[model samples]
Target: MKTDDPTMLAAHDWDFPVPIAYGPGRLAEMGRRCIELGIRNPLIVTDRGSRDLPFIGQLQSLLENEGLSATIFSDISPNPVDSEIGLGRKAFRAGGHDAVIAIGGGSAMDGGKAICLTANNDHDLWAFEFEQPVPVIGQGENFPALITIPTTAGTGAETESTAMVTHADKGMKFCVWHPDLKPALALLDPELTVGLPRTLTAWTGADALVHAIEAYLVPGFNPLCDGLALEGLALIAKWLPVAVDEPQNLTARGGMLVGSSLAGIAFLKGLGMVHAISHMVGAEFNTQHGLTNAILLPVVLRFNLPGQEEKVRRMAQAMDLSDTSVEGFIAAVETMLDQTEIPKSLGEIGVPADCAARIADKALKDSAARTNPRVATQAEVQAMIEKAIAHAR
Candidate 1:
């Protein structure tokens, strides 16, 4: 791996940061953290599916014991739309919440973050959509304090400063960005993820791996992110299967939770075509995000290998591949996927062939495309999609 290409190393800017309270029993400090952030009346934002969880009840009780009044806002969907954020803002205003306590998976966490911001604003949320030649997040200095408690080990939404909210009219997932959108604190408790279903374990774990891989492969000069991504990949490779196989294994769960957060930090440099394509497909077909990334990763790896051979070689070494070639690295990924019983193709996950062109068109316009090592055309992305569909397991 040569480091002569300064072009590949250039980056707009760089930062390595996040405030996290991480451990197996870290949820115990959630209310205390909220109180420290001046949240007397906190809005608990989560998806409907998680509202009934025993932990939710426990969390409410804990807040009550801490002399905090809490309101439950679980009206978000798996892929939260802007309208849902609007509804959540209404809920926040009606409840007169002073702060937000976002809990649950990526969807719930992202929706909560958006809801927290929108609660005090009277303008449309779409005004914040990340546009190129400009920053991803627009100018917004005012926002309520937020604390995130992730119930899943993927999506890294808890660790990022961006939110992916669907625009109902556009029917596409758009990112809302703000430096202030980052939660003041993140609590990572492996116990929260111990009960994740096997299917979700594989899906979200794969999503975490994709985040690391794409971040490593994306052309950038952020060595800190690159290092984090590599370590994250190694952690996922070693621990994801253990987690999926033995759901109650705290060590594996904790490794995955840390790996997922590290991956989130890594992608702050940028993500590549895997995310671009995955976001489009997820918005269109209502597919699971991690599943889509898992299915598309191999194909995107192959697509990105032309000018990125050295980076892929480094990734192979990081993944501990016996064969350091691109093909060998991809083969190792396939074996890992097979071991986890993750489906091999987009079609297997209910993505339609007819939507490939549209997905490709949208993917080319995605913010992630700007960082991809391989500059892909719409036709090339479409061909990759076709190959991914044809190769579905």
Candidate 2:
């Protein structure tokens, strides 16, 4: 296969920057990876809910057996805020840890990434935000060596170089992007996801779908990322329901795990309105990330329909929907949401109509909002929020 041949384009530009090992029980090798990375003392950053799980206990024991003392920082919350990052940073520094082992969902992984950055940087995390022509964080600076183990099959935080941390006082999500934030290694072990609740499985799986769909429809369609986005979409369409309905289905879990990682890689090209709108809804309402994406997905698809009709038609075919029309594609997504038992509206998740404008304004300013197929004006964004609010009602 010629490297530049169109047939090989996907494989050529598709770069898996971090080493990712995928399989059942692959997490058991995390300690070995840590050793290879020269980590003597590693801090496992995770949420409190995951600490009691047998898988997490097993990881801890594995580290202990390797003569590496692993400290647990399970104080992170669902929408991890700056305070959580600060606390995690303090814990990391005090423990004299050499590396970070992020374990769990997006929140835990993001928290771990933030702590790693703060541990090595002199400036505060928020100071690294990109503004206008100035780039956030200098180039080529190395943070702590980081390893990631995702317990959920969504968020793909393990593969990305960005972290979304909620503001301390504003109650809005802010992202910190830097090459240094990417994990040194990622382990995708489906066994760690077997204990995920049906609701969580559906929510996170939907998030993965949104990532792939939005990345595919976003303005810049890099051939490499488009292939990944489409493949990820197909996997989620086929496996998410099975994983949600049958918690013990390792095959479904494995597919979702791989799909999530692919979606993360796809988003490197760009993401669309679904993420921009969902981020606002999530931060303002404290809704689950995947659930928020699922709720706003069809609405964003409809809003971008005029420009993305062909893409939606192709997506409809990929999802195996009978209808190829834009509306048909939207309906298919809605159907998937219904099958997964995801909420249909923002109101269902406690987002008030009065707060819609504020969320819309913030969304318009988000970096993800810039890459949307149709660049949303403030009025257009506000209208989308109203539509979302009405849909929820």
Candidate 3:
């Protein structure tokens, strides 16, 4: 299980956080890991959809057999807002839960993480917004121990310290971050992902690609992230199609899980415009985060291509494309999108033309936008949105 890449090893040093349990059939280890971590009373936070699955009941039974009593909180929505986080926090405190077991997709993991953070903090959740002009002020040390078991292979929520939640009032997504919020453990069981539908497979798989591409392109000095991003991109390029077409293919599923995690780790260095726009659009429209990002990625790439020629060339190499130019890269991505049956434009995915102005305004203020290689203005973002919407039909 050792990687020869020094950068990958460096990225996993003790300082990086998240002890991962990866591979097929690793879901059975969750109860043991919880016990080893001394979590006697655990809150299982997930979406309502996941709660209905047979695996959810099986996991709870496993925990009870291991002497860990668990409570379930599955009222959260696909785009978790502050109200949901507030409810989750209340459940955490009222149930006397000592730790969090976040299981399912991105929304469940993020809602659980937010609940864990706010359960101990006295201030409002937005007080810790990562996009603010000044750095978030907090005690930064105390939180319920967290374990994430991802049933899907997107968002990389299992390993990252940042959580995205929509503001109930503003209808905008904001990231709350603290080093203590990083999960104590991440269990990736590909067997759990075998039931994913083709559309979800395409969306989540494309979302992972956006993370890797943005992380690699963002101007930074972190070689560890660069190496991991390149590797992640390569893996996704090779395996995502196979995974989408053949859901039961363990090798493809496993590769996607690992690639998604690597992409998440790489984004610790930060993301770029695709995430910025995707967050805004998703919060307002309640669209799927990964699908929104997938639709916007090609245009965002075109917008950022002016100064990123050299990096795109390297990315082309990683993607194993014969053409190493930016145009070639964009074409390859479009081809991938077509192959995956992804919607061609924002309009196709229900993002309206009228939201263009609002999305642009929010995108400019997003933390991810600040790290974009090429500075993007509201006008430019609006133009991109228009193009994205028009191109869909």
Candidate 4:
């Protein structure tokens, strides 16, 4: 976000983890890309809110003009469930869709991936879950492709190869992973995000920040992911406030958009307690993912990142902190929390105080906790949740 050049951000294509077409107004080229994927008919998977956006209609026209038919499947929820994916699979089959174009936030994208993975197979969805002892035998690789166009700058679902959906019966959010689930292309258009509510802009930006922070601290030897996380943390720290305040600033929007995707890419190295706890909290409270993350991050940082002096120093530098210590980075998070108007406590946002044990039990079961630098016991996690619930930050 700081540069001596003082130049405009330009549109460009990148192929780090996938084919990414990033810029403002790149939605105009969606039709050409569909053709290249041999998609004569595509299913547009999005949430009800995004389905009502004007660009949805324009996107249909864009595809239609290119000799491709696009159908809408917008029966998605904020946190996708197995039933929603079932409906999407049915819609995909009924429409005779050749590929999928998921264009919205994380839920829509995850739903799209689940639909794509199960459209041609009758395998039980849970059988393919990453945590299953035995993997499901079948998949739908024969499908043409999946293209993700994110309207929000969080979750990085565009770059993820897993779909996190709630189990209706279990009442918990769980993820399914398969290499085939990764999107063939991700289109990032800052213009599409300009209309996002200011609060959502702030929350989602904080979500990206948490992603980079957690991934950076995940005990790992992947220097590639480490570098990406550090750089992404820097970008989000520099640009999130601008995006939140000046919703129309294309440069700030672009910065958060790319920073979010980079964080998403980095988290492929794996997340930590932040996601582990957030996934469960979201299932129980139906809270926004980013809001929960933003509220929980300050607390989680103290619990997870205290003694890693070297990593802490590097993170401080990445965030441009003058003090270059853990507390300095935390003060920065607290400042952003105020700027974003995030609640001081999870209880303020409606997470009940009495449910810490249940939430912590489930959070421990979540795969994300496996990579947290400081391993947590159930009591430790519950205590952390209690403090979070009580406005400990």
Candidate 5:
């Protein structure tokens, strides 16, 4: 029995930064995964609009079928605010939830992540906004196990450890981060994303595009993120318009989902001005984050990519554009905007052009702004915002 065999190979395990169970019907595996995570009592956090959706009930029944308890906390709104997550933390604690099963777009996913962050921590939520020396996040049950099922491809909140929640007192969206907030698993079931409203499809796709572009352009030395961003850009470029026109095209949906996730991972290298500008605007206007990004993308790109012709050429190649110049890449972006019917100006989306100064001040303070290739001033940010307001008007 002790014979030494030279060819013996032991079984091994493989995992990514966040393990993803991806496909059309991966939602079916949720129950077993919950068990594996020791999540018998889970709180399902979602946005207000997603509460009545069929998948909510489907997931509930699926969990119940496994003898697990599923309670929904859909009090969150778009651009989720502090009060909502405060209430969610209360619900999670009161319900004795062992985990959070967050399902929906960015707001819900981000809210769930925030809830997980504040659920057991004694410090006030705002006190934890990412700082020089990160707070010691207690492990084990102090942080609830999280499983994210993203219904939208934008934000990539599922894969990231950061969540942007509005601080009601300041009326600002703060990026609060902790590594433990990333989900134990991300279920990317394209079937869930299919049939998304037309506007959302376009807007969220643009959000992914911005993530890829900004991640690539940010002053960075990470070749890994650069490669992922290019691939993500290619996928988004190819599939976004098709998804918009076709709606139920599984292939397009799957491509967007994968591309969006890649952008999510890529931006760990950090994002740039488009996100810096959009974050402040989204908080102030209560606008869709993706829509705001989509409108502001071209204007920000015109500013960031002008002197960088070599970078623009690579971006052009990734998008399969023939011209391979900064001008040509922008033309392609404009054409995409037109094809998807994205509003050309932030003004068209009810964002008042008058608040440029206020938005600029807040945007300059945003962490993303620091990573932008250009050292933009308050005046510069305001000018950019104003130009984006009148971009097509």
Candidate 6:
């Protein structure tokens, strides 16, 4: 896993944050990892939608059979809020849980991380916002060990040190970053994603594609991240459609899992306008993260194309598009979107026209937007939002 790229060497110190075990059925070893982490009692955090699923139930049973007591907390929502984190902390303390096993998609994993970071800290979770980076966890002592199991092929939340949490009153998204928030281990079991619906598979996979594309085009591209971004983009291009068309395709699923993880790693270097805008829309409209990302992908690409033409051309080459033009790559992305049945516009997702200006204003301030190749103004962001809405129509 050594890379010799100078940019990567300069941008990052080549640190792999967590121990990752990736395979088709690695989830079966969760009990052993929990024991190795010295957890006799573990709280399993997941979303309500995934609590009763076969995978969660099976993991719970496996842990119980191994003589580990487990408590399940499934009250988290799609965009986890501070209240949910508080509730999870309460549950953890009540159950006397020693460690956490986050066993679902991004929300569950993030919620679990939030609980772990704040379990010993007395301040509210919002105090750890990414903007100020103060009141940092792991400031004085070690945090609890966490194990993550992602049931989706997107969001890469399991690998990163930050969790995107929604502010309850502000109705906006903020990040909680702490070194301790990084999982002690990530068990990527592609088998857990096989039963996902086609729409979800397409949406999440498209989100991964955006992550790679954005990372590749971000202003501070480093060789290490660029290589990962390029490979991730290629993998998604080759495998996402297959996974969408055939959910049971194990090979396709595996490719997607790897692509998603690579995308996560790449974004650690930087994300861009697509995530910035998508987060605003998602928080405001309660839209699906991946689907919103899919709808906004081409528009953001087009908007950034003026400044990112060279990068887009490079991405086109990686995607095997013969034309090597920004428009060529954009067209290729459009074709992929069409093939996956991803919506072409924001209107399709119930994002109202009137809200466009507000979303733009917020997106202009998003942390991800700052890394975009072309730093956009509020007016420009509004225009792009309008374009996305019209395209969706």
Model 1: CA > 4 A from native: 1-16, 132-141
The local lDDT score (0 to 100) that residue 282 gets in candidate 2 is: 76
Q: Which stretches of candidate 3 lie over 4 Å from their true place?
A: 1-16, 132-141
Pairing residues by index, what is the TM-score of model 6? 0.93
* Each prediction's whole-model lDDT (CA): 0.83, 0.81, 0.85, 0.86, 0.86, 0.83
What's model 2's TM-score? Answer: 0.92
10 residues in a row with least lDDT, candidate 6: 5-14
Q: What is the lDDT of residue 217 in candidate 4?
A: 92
TM-score of each: 0.92, 0.92, 0.93, 0.96, 0.94, 0.93
Q: For residues 129-192, could you state the per-residue lDDT of candidate 2 as single tens digits?
A: 6432323454544577888889999898787657888886887787776754667788888878
Pull out the clashing pairs in model 3: none
CA shift of 260, model 5, Å:
0.3
| Global Cα RMSD, each model | 6.6, 5.2, 3.9, 1.8, 7.1, 5.2
Residue by residue across 1-393, what tens digits does model 5's lDDT show? 122212111111225667887777778888998998888999999999999998999999999999999899999989999999889989988998888888999999888998888887776777669754567765543677888999987877787668888888897888987765667888888889886999999999999999999999988589989998999998889888888988987778888888898888899888888888899999988999999999998888888897889888998899999999888999999999899999989998888989999999999888899889888999989999999887742
Per-residue lDDT of model 4, residues 123-230, tens digit only:
667766878854444544354478999888888779766889999888899988666566889999989889999989988888999999999999969999999999
As for lDDT, the candidate ahead, 3 or 4, is 4
Per residue, candidate 1 scores C-alpha lDDT tens digits across 1-393 of: 121222212221122365777777777777787778888998999998899998899899889989999989999888888889998999988988888888999899889988876777765687667772323333543677888888888887776658898888887888877665667888888888999999999999999999999999887588999999999898788788888988988878888888898898899899999999888888878888888899898898888876677887888887778798888888889888888888878888888788889889998888998899888898999999988887843
Off by over 4 Å in 2: 1-15, 130-141
How far does residue 362 in candidate 1 sit from its true spot (Å)? 1.1
Q: How close is candidate 4 to the true structure, as a TM-score?
A: 0.96
